[model samples]
Target: MTTTPASPDSTMEAIGQAVIEGRAGDIATARQKLLDIWSTTGATGDPLHRCSLAHYMADLYEDPAQALAWDIRALDAADSLTDQRVQEHHTALQVAGFYPSLHLNLADNYRRLGSFEAATEHINAAHEHAPNLPQDAYGALLRTAIEQVSEAITQRNTAKRASAPGHPA
Candidate 1:
């Protein structure tokens, strides 16, 4: 028995339309259809489709954590495929040997999760990696500097609390 392969573009378009129409059930169905096609047919999958699906999952899925997971998956999809504009693909890609924007994302995620030390670490990495005016839109260097400065501020406050020994004010 033979099965027909799905048209990746068509499936993506349907998913996009479903999202646009606010058909939550249909959108989920279409997204799952694409996932099934990608998993079974080995399609590279459309980065934009994954991004849109991620947004849909984030906005409509009723779970903040799941939404974040979908967002990360979207980023993963974007990273997996490549074109002439590699910079447009993933912020984590290194250019001139630095990726401050990616690090900043990492820092912010960590900060939100209350991992201040890890956040500070990545923020400092962003500063060290960027260290100068960035020429590209990523602003990797500038992002790193900003996050590093913010991490420093957090560190100072933490140290103050430690010295006080009774209050964290």
Candidate 2:
């Protein structure tokens, strides 16, 4: 019997729900749901699903080391991803645009872990990829965050950024 591929739409919908739960202050439930979904994706499953799942999963943790692990997984899946695949799921999405955010998160995680060298490396990577980001508000936000992380690195401050998405604004 032939196997049917998992639908990206459904995967994205589930991911979205988990993100909403996390945003609504139900991080434990959201993290559990995403973990359940991640079991299906595995390390070799869909790159898009792995990337999105790991990226959000990273945010659910207050521990920098834990976030770093998930962010690394997100970055690895992103390295395996393609613009064509991303565009197929969302016409407006370009894989190039994903690098900036991925690198920024890695930078932030590393900074919080007191790995300033790695944080600088990732922040630089984020800067290099920033031009691929659109001029929209989301892009602006990432850019501002990149700057914040970079400044924090220079200050050798290992504190979590106030502007970070997972943090209370």
Candidate 3:
């Protein structure tokens, strides 16, 4: 019997496998393999996969801003999918609700880029989302830890300003 043609899901699965195995080159190659098929079919999976690949690649590119763009694209692709998938992807992801992982990543990016306000915003969002996390003894320790880090950074800067040579105490 003749073998059936591979589907988009299979292509995505391959890409995921490559990604999981820490084979960035293979991941990109697998993604490109599906790109041609998507281009021919004009399949919606195109953007979804592209967004995913781009997001991963962005991190590897050492550019947080680019990563954010890819994340936005992923969100847009999820929104544009069929009603059922839209609900499953978009609704479940909760654009309005805080997403700890995304927020944490964004927060770190903002911090590195010296955008303290934006970093704090994401940190706050993360805390809001994970209000029940456990810390050493107190509840929601992760949230507390994040807050402490953000606050420490801010406070250190403030103290630096006050202690600057010839500056008033």
| Tens-place lDDT digits, model 3, residues 31-60 | 454345446534355554554444444343
Which stretches of model 3 miss by more than 4 angstroms? 1-8, 21-54, 74-98, 131-169
Rank ordering of all candidates by TM-score, starting from the highest? 2, 3, 1
**Any idea what lDDT model 2 has?**
0.90
Clashes of each: 2, 0, 2
Best by the TM-score measure: 2
CA RMSD of all predictions: 12.1, 5.3, 11.6
Model 3 Cα displacement at 152 (Å)? 7.2
Q: What overall lDDT, based on C-alpha atoms, would model 3 receive against the true structure?
A: 0.47
Candidate 1 regions with alpha-carbon error over 4 angstroms:
1-98, 131-133, 136-145, 148-169
Please provide the root mean square deviation of candidate 2 (C-alpha atoms, Å): 5.3
lDDT values for all models: 0.47, 0.90, 0.47
Candidate 2 lDDT score at position 5 = 35
User: What lDDT is reached at residue 136 by model 2?
Assistant: 81
Error of 3 at 111 (Å): 1.4
